[model samples]
Target chain A: MFFVKNIRIGFRRHPLFENLSFAELKPGTMATIIGPNGAGKSTLLRTIAGLHPMLSAAGSANKSGKAHPEQPPIITLGEIAIENLSLQQRVKHIGFVPQVLPQASSLSPYEVIFSSIKSVQPDLNREEADQRIEPVFRKLEMDSLAFEPMHTLSGGQRQIVSVAQILVRRPQLLLLDEPTSALDLRWQLKVFEALQDQVKSTGAVCLMVMHDLNLALRVSDYLIALSAGHLLAEGAPVEVITPAIIRQIYGVIGRIETCSQGRPWVIADETV
Target chain B: MLNPPAKQIAGTSTLTNRHQQVVARRVLCVTSLVVAMLFIFLLDLATGASNISFSQVLSGLLNSSELTTPEAVIIWELRLPYSVTALLVGLALGLAGAEMQTALNNPLASPFTLGLSSAATLGASLALAFNWNDIALTTHLIVPLFAFAFAAGATALILFLARVFDARTGTIILFGISLTFGFNAMVALVQYLSDADTVQQIVFWGMGSLARTSWEKIAIIFMVLVICVPASIIQVWRQTMLRCGEEHAKAAGVDVDRLRRTLMLRVSLLSAIAICFVGEIGFIGLVGPHIGRLLVGEDHRFYLPASALSGAVLMLLASLASKTLVAGAILPVGMVTALVGVPLFVLLIFTYARRQP
Candidate 1:
């Protein structure tokens, strides 16, 4: 199981959220964190990914002058604390895809993914590395564009490449911050399907920070809602996403509607 | 849904074939550049003040004892040192530039971007102005020794600042720019205070030349390249990941901050030794990697050696032009490098642009 306990994250002096703990995430499930703007969704994902630092309880002085817990946050995968693991060990277990797209360059997507895997697993020869990479490209259906330079690829295509890079590593826990932000609707669904397949096949836990609440509700096995440094709700999407909770979190009057396939669909009616 | 087994096999084979073809093409490009560099190296060895023919130079190289004393001295002592220094210096700058650009994440970064060349120039200027040769045991070596010391000092300072400031790419670049400007000003002040002959000597050094190289200097530079190039090649995968972006590299488990620091140290060592031995050979560090990137893309496995070979060839050709461009008066190799490299670089860029559909 993946778990975060009493995590507080923010910039140096200002704490965005404190004493935030969530442990409902289990293996072989896709979880999505959804919130309004500045709700610390990405920051939370980054903290779990080890890209951002978790604040000490005695972080910095705040205007309210409230003392937090003295201990640092504990993030664990299975039984091991993430902070206690070495960099190589952490990478082998956790994969993170940041929100930003990669810079344009002469490197092809194939080269980027191949090199990414080789860098982490340097003992793997070319054939072994190629064996790992070809399947990902085929699964993602990016085989034709594999050799094209990154600069020539579209933003959505590059986003897929970024996802593909992390997937090839086959980490036990995947953390992606808005992985589908740049993708079109079809590509976004394809990426979701790919993530689902990965979770089902490998029993990996995938946590993604998503902007589109409707899509998150439609696809995620588990849903987390945050608002103003608070966990507004967390559970199965059908149980967690209600009109009242949506209004409280997003400050918009939203209705929960069921799709033809019996998935929850969020319909924003108007600003509250 | 997956493809059928037969089609999947076919697709895999096609990808393997395409990848092999790409690797083969890059290997061919690097091999051709090495061949060109060798040809220019021979040409450089043959063309000098002494009236040695290409065949004579080859025979002399093959059998040193068969040649007369004067011929041996001319070939072994003078021409051989000059040509080898040019080749090694070219290799150093090109490799340094490629690493620097990747580490700094800036396309325009070169070996001199960190101000090592300017620091060397300042050192040479101070040695010239103060006439340090009078106190030194080896008169001819005083200036280069001073230059090397100052360049190494500057490198240490940069590394120290990088460590203190967390080695952010933007902060390192800003510090490097400041160092370059500060060193250039110091060089100017020393130049202004020096006597006319001292000023002339400093100016010549600033223009740079391979004329003053010796066997010892060539060996020193060769040793440095030997150690640094392989060290760099070992990090080829990490460096290639860096070319994608720092964040990407970091996510791939690379310690970006540590990688930057190590890369800076290697680049500083290569360029410091190179610039100290031969005044300030510009253009090679800046353009060699560009030519290499155009020839073989950013895969550092191919790109690094390609950059080194490109630099070696450019330097050898420039050294040859410096010797033969005028009658009996060899121009400074530094000046010839820009003159020879600019047109060729421009043509390469145009061709690359045209080929990109």
Candidate 2:
């Protein structure tokens, strides 16, 4: 399970999120955090990944200069406190996919993925490393594109390569920031299906920050909606993505309709 | 459920074969570069003013006791030290340049981007202008000593600033550029204040030459390369990870800041040692890695060694040209480096452009 409790994150003077907490997400569950712009969605994901700083109870004083009585924030994966683990230990269990794509270079996707594995597990021989990487490329359908230089790959292709880089590690908790932002509809569906299969097979938890609510509704097992640093709603996709919550989160008049597969689909008509 | 699809199996086999082919091609490219570098080293040894034949050069190398006195003296005393110095300096600069570019995440960055060469120039300028050779105790060693000290001092300052400010790659690069300009201006001021003879000497030193090297200097540089190259080799995976991006490297548990700092220190040491002796040989550090990348992509295992060999080859070719360009009067090797390197670099770029889709 993965959870964060009373995690206040952002600048010291003006905390973006104060006393914010997330409910427990069990292993094998795929969850999405959906929000409008400036909702601290990416910041929250970064904090959980141990990339961004979270303010402590002692450091987060109110405007009137009194410290809150709350304890320091606690983030745990399974039974271990994430902050207590060393960086090497933390990365073995948690993988973070940042929003930015990999830079264009002469390196091929195969080299990048190979080196990523070798960087952490230097003891693995070339054949052992190849055994780990071959299936990932095959599963992602990127085998043909694996040997091409990164600069020649499309943005969506590069994004897939970035995803493959992390997936090869097989982390227990995968935190992805907008992994499918640059992907087309077909690729997006393929990526979602891949993530679903990965979660099912490995019993890993995936938490993604997603902007496309329809896609989120179609794929996510659970949803958490954030608006202006506040949790608007959190529950099953059908229950949390109602018209009222849409208005509160995006200030738009949205209606949730059932798709052919009986999943909720969100459509926005006008700004509130 | 018992068997996989035939098409899937076929695809897997093809992928494995193609991967093996790619690895084989890279290995062949590196091997070819090593052969070319050895040929150039022999050519450099044979091309001095004494008109030594390639056979004679080989004989002198294989069995020095059989050579005439003058031939032995020329081969053992002058050409050997000069040629070895060029080779080692090239190796050092090439490795330093590759690391600097990766550490800064900028393709245009070279070992000199951190201002080591400019600082060395300022030190040499100061030594020439103030007549530090007049001091009896230091005598012959004053100029190189001063150049080395200033270069090291500049690196120490950059590292100190990086630590104090917790600076990232961009900030570190900015500090290095500022130091380059500052050191260049200081060198110019010293040149303006000096006498014509001193100014001329400084200019000649700045143009760089391997004519003055001794075996002791060669030994120092070789020892440094022996220590630094293996250090770089062990970090090939980490450095290749860095090529993806700093965020990716950090996410993979690499301490990017620490890696950058360590690489900078090694680059500074390598370039400082080379520049203090050779004055300011250019182009090899900047272009060697680019050529290496074109030959064998950025897998540092191949890339690093390829860069080092390419640099040594380039330096040897430049050294040969320096001796032969003006018949009897040897031009500075620095003057010949760009003359030899630019055309080859342009050709490689064109070849790479044609090959890329």
* TM-score on alpha carbons, each prediction: 0.94, 0.94
Residues B55-161 of candidate 2: C-alpha lDDT, one tens digit per residue: 99898899998789999999999998889999999999998998999999998889888888999999888877877546543324778888999999999999999
Off by over 4 Å in 2: A60-70, B1-12, B133-140
lDDT of 2 by residue, A122-227 (tens): 7778788787788888889987677888988889999999889878888899889999999999999998888889888999999999989888988899999988
- Enumerate the candidates' DockQ scores in order: 0.45, 0.42
Tell me the deviation in Å of residue B244 in model 1: 1.7
Per-residue lDDT of candidate 1, residues B1-357 (tens digit):
123233456645666566777789899999999999999999999998879889999998999987999999999888998899999999999999999999998989998888899999998888778775464433358788889899999889988988887767888888888999999999889988888888888899998898778887888898998899789988899899888787778778887777888899999999999989789999999999999999999999999999999999999999999999998988999999999999999999998888677
Worst 10 residues of 2 chain B by lDDT: B1-10
CA lDDT of every candidate:
0.86, 0.86
Interface RMSD of 1: 4.8
Best prediction by DockQ:
1
Candidate 2 differs from the real structure by a C-alpha RMSD in angstroms, to one decimal, of 3.9
